[model samples]
Target: MLWNKKEKNKPKNISLKLYSFNEEIIFNGLLTNFPIKEELILEKTIEHFEDYDPCFFHRSVVSRWMYFEIEEYLNKIDEENKSEIKWQELPENIKKILLSDKVINRVIVEKI
Candidate 1:
């Protein structure tokens, strides 16, 4: 797809980490808050939170936080067996984002 200057600036990936605090918090920061969800996603082209909170970096946003290859990470979310995350359980920020469906024209298993 050909993205122009304006469109390219939009956040292509929404970063999140699992088990941030202590243990067993899969899809960690994915369900966390970021001040105000509407303000952030709207104002900024790309939102990043690698160190703001602690968690396993499941989605590789950039080279600096590259735990897994981008292709592999994207593919992982496509699989059918991806964990199911309840909508009510999601934090306000994440819930709004996912529900808005700003992701893109792709097949990403956005359960958890």
Candidate 2:
């Protein structure tokens, strides 16, 4: 089945990890608190993977957050729409935050 019978009513909790040059920072919370622009990505991933009782897909979630955050920063700079922005065009501070080793590195979703 697309959805696991036992996981149908479980609460989804998300764990995020950020890795730096010398340290790793972890954040834990409900999946609802995560920022996902496309709900279909999560739903489809769950449907296709039967063993994903506790889904371990960090890159997708973090990449989404990164895109949104950068878009927000872009919007603040001007009123026109910026559908395609290049990394080199971003301001130094914005680039610094994105390039920082401390940014999110992993995401885990557990059904509890």
Candidate 3:
């Protein structure tokens, strides 16, 4: 936690080529339409992100990190709550980007 503040405040840069194609036009339009907060969340949630060129895999990395973050929070709650809680009873944010059964099993198997 010593460097939590520094890590939280770290700057991220995002850049992509703007082509004259129809796909690029639609992509740029969507980016401009989204509110700033969603954009900020995408920047903050992405971890160990390195994209030298535009790629779909970067989004996958960000999504996986988001799921991992939710899983970590769930682990904390399980440690503190002591009582069992149904997954549906959890908050919406916790259910937003759920990890698959395979991934969940992997986490458990790693602990064994």
**Predictions in order: lDDT:** 0.34, 0.41, 0.36
Clashing pairs in 3: none
The 10 consecutive residues of candidate 3 with the worst lDDT sum are: 103-112
What TM-score does candidate 2 get on C-alpha atoms? 0.27
lDDT of 1 by residue, 1-107 (tens): 11124544333333444332234433433222212233433333244643433233322233222212222343344453544334444445444344432322222
Candidate 3: C-alpha RMSD after superposition: 16.1
**Would you estimate the TM-scores of all the predictions?**
0.23, 0.27, 0.33
Regions more than 4 Å wrong, model 1:
1-40, 45-82, 101-112
Clashes of each: 0, 1, 0
- lDDT per residue for candidate 3 within 1-112, as digits (tens), equals 1113344433222111222222222112221121223343456445355444425666555554554454455446545643233444556564444322222111110111
| lDDT value for model 1 | 0.34
Candidate 1: worst 10 consecutive residues by lDDT? Answer: 101-110
- By TM-score, is 1 or 3 better? 3
Q: Can you tell me which runs of candidate 2 are displaced by over 4 Å? A: 1-56, 80-93, 97-112
